[model samples]
Target: MDFTFSTEELLIQQMAREFAEQYLRPATRRIEKENRVPDEILAGLAGLAGLDLFGMNIPEQYGGAGAGYLSYVLAMEQIARVHCGPGLILSAHNLGLGAIANFGTDEQKARFLPKAASGEHIASFAFTEPGTGSDPKQLTTTAVRRGDEFILNGAKRFISNAGYQGPLTVFAIEAESGVPTAFIIDKFCPGYSISQPWEKLGWHGGDVVDFNLKDVVVPLDNVLGKIGDGYPILQFGIAYGKIGMNSLALGSTLAALELAVRYANERTHREQPIAKFQAIQLKVAEIAGLYESSRWLCYRLGFLANDPKSYRDFAREAALAKAVVARNAQEAARISLDVHGSYGLMQDAEIARVYRDAAMGPQIEGVLHMQQIILAGDILRKR
Candidate 1:
């Protein structure tokens, strides 16, 4: 397999790098402090012709850039390298949007994709509930069928982008069949309301909040895939979601490596640069190794996503990649912090922010142990 990026891929990567450096880097502090991305930044990100980032993975027929998953991964890494908040927003958006793109009817695609691709609305996926932690069997949400609509009632927790005006793919159990199903509902509909945004440790501007659906009526056509197909749909969404998560972790690892190397060169120890120190050199080398390893794993996962042999195989690979990359990012960040010594502990330090962001990598999307379980199960089954 060739390791080189195509010319178009390189261009997309360069565009994303420039955008992150020019726009996101300057606003990183503001985003972190305010806990919100500026409307101008969001508009620029979506409206820019060469950098239609929100639509990278969407097909061209849906008014997206149609850059494919590899292009999307390249762009996400650059974006997250400067600041992860925007990356988080894009990742969660795609998590929901990918589900619809892969499973929705043409009519549903026609209705939802254009606006979402244009960033007039941001998409969200809802699966987790107060009672369920990655367990679909424990879902308490209920969907009751009526003449032409299904009335939904449930509470979703830790949902990202729930406050955004767009399509939200929600999972609930159908009352008649007692089977879980996925539904597409417009955000802030008559019976939809969101709680205050949850204060998160990192990725500040990427909003996460609790939301309630009280008799939220969804049209019959909005049922994604088939009735009682929520499990497969959920698996597909989570698998694709892991690709975004891996990209973010890889970016964080790269950032941490860069920060450590820069600190080593700039900080003087005994009237000489700290790079002269073997301990500092070793730490830098370790961080670099982590970055490189995580980078390839993330890129490979993205490539696999473009044309997977099977969803089960793709899901297994995604789990493996995330388990390694997320933990590597966290380890790299910790090593970078050690390189910074006491200064890293200060709130004003850049490495401190990177540390916090890296800390989230292993926890979000799926916990580390859960990823282990997925991969382990796959291996055991093969045996």
Candidate 2:
């Protein structure tokens, strides 16, 4: 494999780096303390939109930049280098756009993609219900057709990006077929309300809320893909979501590793820099290796996206990537904190927040064990 980024990819990565330094780095402390994102994603989204980014991985015909998966991943990694908050905001919005781009009718595309491309609107996806997380087969959200509209009734929790008043792509079972279907509903639709904001451990800058659809009305034209085809659409969307989340892992891990290496060299112990110590050396080596492994996995997933045959294989790989990178990043962050000694625990120290975010790795995307089940399924399929 070439293992080289294209010009576009490099440019986007550079842009992301700059975005993080200016917008994210300066605000990390405040965002964590205030527990609000300050509409943070909007700033980055507007900037990227100028570069024709917002829906970059989607096709141009769908009002995206058509920059390909690798370019998007490169940008996402850079943005995530600072913190998971902003990157997650963009990621969740993209997931909503991807579902529409991949499955929506031309009219639906014409209506939503243009606004999405320019960052004029953001989006959120709702799938996980109050009772269901992993097993979605028992989803109780039902959509019944009534003339030109569909009436929806259900509730979903742990939904990111739902705090925004934008288009929401919700998954519900069609009343007649009892099969999962997706619909695009306006946030202002009557009977659609988000539950009170939920406090979270990490990712404090972004919004996380529960979404409820009580006899919500959705136009039949907004149905994404065929009725009962939500399973595949959901899979395809989350496959990319997994890749994006783990890419954040790679970026955060890189930050942690860099911080540790720098701290080891600058910190003094016994009248000598801690870099002189073998223990510090081992920690740096472990972190660098782990980061490199997880990062390469992200790049591979980006490339695999170009090949249709690899998608089935890619889904399992994506799950593994999320799980591995989350674990690896947490380990790297812990060692980095240890290298900082007691200073790392101080709220004034930036690494303190990075440490907290890293500890949240297993919770992002999906739990580590659940992802392992996907890998196990792949193994059994091979047999």
The clash count for each model shown is: 0, 0
What tens-digit string does per-residue lDDT give for candidate 2 at 259-353?
A: 99889888897889999999999999999999899888888887787564766787887888888888898888888999899989897776777
Clashing pairs in 2: none
lDDT of each: 0.90, 0.80
Q: Against the true structure, whose TM-score is highest?
A: 1
Off by over 4 Å in 1: 45-50
Error in Å for residue 271 of model 2: 3.1
List ranges where model 2 is wrong by over 4 Å: 44-48, 51-53
lDDT of 1: 0.90
Q: Please provide TM-scores, in order, for all candidate models, with all chains considered together.
A: 0.98, 0.94
The lDDT leader among the candidates is 1
lDDT of 1 at 80: 89
